[model samples]
Target chain A: MNIDAFAFDFQELNKEIKSSGQEELNIDNCMGQRYIGCGLSRGSLRIRGVPGNALGAYLNGADITVHGNAQDSVGDTMNEGKISIHGSCGDTPGYAMRGGKIFIRGNAGYRAGIHMKSYRDKCPVMVIGGSAGSFLGEYQAGGRIIVLGLGSDQPCPVGYFCGTGMHGGKIFLRCGQLPASLPDQVNAKLADDVDLQEIEEDIRQFCAEFDLDRETILDHPFHVLTPNTKNPYRQLYVHC
Target chain B: MQIDYFYPEYEVVRNKEKCTRCGLCVSQCSNHVHSYSEEHRRMITDDAKCVNCHRCVCVCPVGALKITGSNHQFKHNANWSRRTIMEIYSQAETGGVLLSSMGNPKDMPVYWDKILINASQVTNPSIDPLREPMETKVFLGSKPASIERDENGRIRNNLPPHIALDVPILFSAMSYGSISLNAHASLVHAAVDLGTCYNSGEGGLHDDFYRYSANTIIQVASGRFGVHKEYLEAGAAIEIKMGQGAKPGIGGHLPGNKIVGEISKTRMIPEGSDAISPAPHHDIYSIEDLRQLVYSLKEATGYKKPIIVKVAAVHNIASIASGIARSGADIIALDGFRGGTGAAPTRIRDNVGIPIELALASVDERLRQEGIRGNVSLIAGGSIRNSADVVKALALGADAVYIATGALVALGCHLCRGCHSGTCNWGIATQDPALVSRLDPEEGRRRLVNLVSAWTHEIKEMMGGMGINSIEALTGNRLMLRGVGLNAKELEVLGIMHAGE
Candidate 1:
């Protein structure tokens, strides 16, 4: 089913999509409509034009593809879904996401993948093809965040304070050197073959999704970042 | 190599004449304050190890043990009290933030004690609660501004989703990670029995507790732990924890060591990973951003459940509450500075937010003046100690009251304020297997039920005394309350008159 969402507000468009009982939907001319597939468990939605903040928040198991740029909080706290953005996205693209995958073909704004955690058998993944803004993966408890930086010349792809307060998870950055502003709480090392194997399938998937050559994307030396200490606050307090 | 400047604050006294060498005290204390001395043929006590939990004293087979404050005191200096001197010494030694558990124990004014309730005389007939049908049931949510009728002239069913409470008392938020599963079960069972609700604070709900979802209010905080589609849909209501009163403006850091096994699974994080809840929601930069979250949750739930926004009772709370009300929240829960916590920095817990009484009064007045009081129901919490405090909160404009410390007290908490150590002898705040097993869920549930039931009965009696047949009638009825020994400025902020006037 194709929906011309030019004249419809977010609530009306969402209501029509939910109540239509269709398994597949194509939302055209979508102009900054927030929460496009909010909490939708099933079905596939293809959105054209710009979508607003929190596009697929709490999405259970649906598939959402945004043709144009998406706003902040693209997949806020989303679980069990796949969101693909063709263009650049705003801040906090995958904030606190527990599961599912978010593939951004273009650069992402600040705080992408912040607090993204993983439970048993459910690991969330986010792949940023271009540079990411500051505080990337801040306080990230689990999951994988890969920044390819497909066409950048900087020392690192992520901005300052990357992985600050990070306690879990690994951030794979395709860079020659780690960010200078990286906090002491996180440790960075050159990616080994064993370390690269963990994210090989995810990188291959990202390459296929964005129609890029896998060999070219994997040509550069990568730096994998992991939290040095799981208990960052163990020594910060004394019992009164 | 270290000189201990601070002495033990408490002394453990054991009576030799009455004592039998049963070794009950040795096993009862989790702090290892008592041990058998084989050489001396008696039990030895470590006063420094004692947290004053009273577990050993209560469980001793013979009446032989008592704990008392040590007579050791600092020099006669008014400013440098004993606690102050010891605290400085301790900080100098460890160089760590002083962390405390439970509510503030500072000498602060509790307005509930200074407020007096009204009774009817010959002017108005006081009804007997036992003989009359006193209505205590309250529906919490937004009420319609005007009545609507269908085409057939019948009243339209335009009421939105709301929660019904048999009494105006609710068990406040205490997460599974910060407390034992048995403690959570007790609150859940008691809430179901009382037709009220218990909140699942920040921590994700355990699978075993899903059966009591009808009486649960699941919370979503900064960390968004264990918060997923299923968890969001499993509760009667959703609460967005903006701030905790005990440590307002600061986020909670449940150390990684405590996040093990069930807690790790429940919170959906790796075992031994720090569960850090950031102070502010990165997505919520303004009221507009808050609205987005509220509506997003609403859309996710299909608008079936109410959304509660819980914030600490801080300065400018009235304005903050107004913003929340306009943000499409169905309820606003205000937790005051004196609210309980599993652990908080001693400085922050002692001197952070305002008292619940004053916060409630100002917020209620602000909402009413703006004609938006019906937009959201107010739940006042902090130090609601007794039935009288509940009554006083209602009179000051709280739709209901949330009780946490009081409920834990009912479940055998000795108020030792040692929850941060993760060695609660009462089993209310620890995740240790043995300590958790100490609290039987059935007994805890019964005690909670008894406490709420007794409080409900007393609330009805107070309403009857005020010539009010229903609790709703007593809400925001400041005439039912009078200030006693409160200064003029204090009464003005409380929005109450003097006792004589």
Candidate 2:
């Protein structure tokens, strides 16, 4: 089923997409249409042109492939699904994600992978191909965030205040130089062999999805950040 | 052991002449406030442990027990009060943030009491509610700005998904860990029976209560605890909990002791780990960011259910509501400062957030002025005690009101203000199995149903008295309301005129 996105309300488009019998939707000319494939499960979506904010939000088990750029809040609070963006995505990608994979072929904006969590077998994985903006993975409780500086011009791959309030989970930045002001609550060091193995399959899939050299991306030194203590707010409050 | 330094705030008097000594209070009190001393052959009261919940007073075989404010006052000074001094002592004793339960009980101005309702006297005849068909049923959702019709000249319903209710009342969010499983069951059953809805707070939906999904509204707070695809699908709607009235700008903290077997499974955390909901949704830093989240939930639910953005009533609420209305939210639920909480820092609960009455009025006026009132339904709450408050809230512009403290009160909550302690003598706010069993859900369900139904009847009658047969006719009809003791600013802010003017 193909829906031409022209002069149609986002709500109307969504309603039609949901009520339609077709499991595969090809939305063309999606000029900044917001909330495409939201909360949808058991579907395959191919979106052309720029999709607006909250693309595939709360998306449950839907596989969305955006051929062009996406605006802010891509995959916000998405539970289980796969969002593959071939172009650069805007801010807050894969935020509060519980289980899913968000593969951005290009750079991501600020606060990507913030508050993403994981349960028993469900670990949400976000792979940003290029450099990410500031406050990356802020207050992340669970899940995995991988920022591979495959192609970026900045002196550092990530901007200021990366993983500021991160408590649980791990943030892997494949960069040589690190930010000067990482919060003292977290530990940032060279990725161990165990950490590399854990993200090996995700890196492989991200590379295959974007047609990148997997070995080259992985050959770079990676830095993994995890909360130093279980109590992140130990020094935050004065007890009284 | 901690030294005993302060006197109790309440004194329990038991009339020995009428005492049968049935030992009900001794067993029923979860705080162990009463015990039958063998040496005295009489029940001795422990005032220090008592929260004045009135469990003993309610359960006493005879009318033999009464609790009153203690006369153990310190030397009075105009600048220093007893409570302030004691609070300082307690904080000094245990260098921890003082936690309290329930709403603010300070002597703040209650705007609800200042407003008055007008009844038809002459020109408009009052309708008989009992004899006539009175429509109290309300549907909460975004209404289309203009009606759309099919090409065949047929009316097309283009409105979004709505939460339909027999009356304009909803049970506000109270987490399972904060309250009890039996309490949740009671609320769920009562909501189902009354054709209303109750919230699951920040706690994940308990597996057993999944059967009552139709009457449930699963809330997504900052914690995202127990938030999964199944949990999102299990409710009629999803509420984005940005803030609560009791503790605005603060995250929720479910103490480790409250995280038991079922709670652990529900929240998807360990058995004894503290569950904390962060202060803000890191994704939503701005109101436009709020729009992103609102759409996210809508997308997640497949646009099948309404998405409510619940916020604490703040100083600049009207503008906040205007932004939320534009954010594609189906409903905006406002909670005032007096709203109940499972637990909150005492200082924050009392001092933070604004009154619901003012927030409701200003937000409604702003939305209507912006011609966006139809875009979102409004629900106001905090301390709506009766049907009149419901009527005033509607007349002031709320589509409906969320009731929590009032609902809990109907279930035998005596406002003991010890909910954070988690040893609720009435079994209304505790997770203890023994204490929880005291509150039979069957009986609780009946009581809640009765309370809501009776309030519905009162609201209908109030509407009829105002010469309005349908609730829609009374909604945002400021002519049906008038200010009594309110000043110019108060009246102007409320958009209502003084009586006889």
Query: What does candidate 2's lDDT look like per residue over A150-177, in tens digits?
Result: 7786656888898887777899989887
Give the per-residue lDDT digits (tens) of candidate 2, residues B1-501. Answer: 544276788888989899888888888888888898899887898998888899989888787999999998889887788877777776666566777789999999899898899899898999899999999999999998878999998989888899888889999999989999999999999999999999999989999888888899999998788887788889998999999999999998775567789998888765655576878887778888888777767766777899999999999999999999999899999999999998788889999999999999999999999999999999999999999999999999999999999999999999988887778987778888999988999999999999999999999889989999877888899888899999999999999999889
RMSD of each: 1.4, 3.3
Q: Which candidate has the highest TM-score of all? A: 1
Report the C-alpha lDDT of model 1 over B1-501, residue by residue, as the tens digit.
Answer: 555555788999999898997998887788999999899888899899999999988988788999999988777898888877777878888999999999999999999999999999998889899999999998888887789999999999888789889999999999998999999989999999999999999999999888888899999999999898889999989999998889999999998889999999999888888899999998898999998999899888888999999999999999999999899999999999999999999999998999999999999999999999999999999989999999999999999999999999999999999998898988888998998999999999999999999999999999999899888998899989999999999899899999999
lDDT of 1 by residue, A44-87 (tens): 99999999889999988999998989999988998888999999
Clash pairs detected, candidate 2 = A38-B299, A39-B299, A39-B300, A61-A80
Lowest lDDT 10-residue stretch of candidate 1 chain B: B1-10
Clashes of 2: 4
Chain B TM-score against the true chain B, candidate 2: 0.97
**Regions of candidate 1 where Cα sits further than 4 Å from its true position:** none
How many backbone clashes are present in model 1?
Answer: 0
DockQ score of each predicted structure, in the order shown: 0.80, 0.30
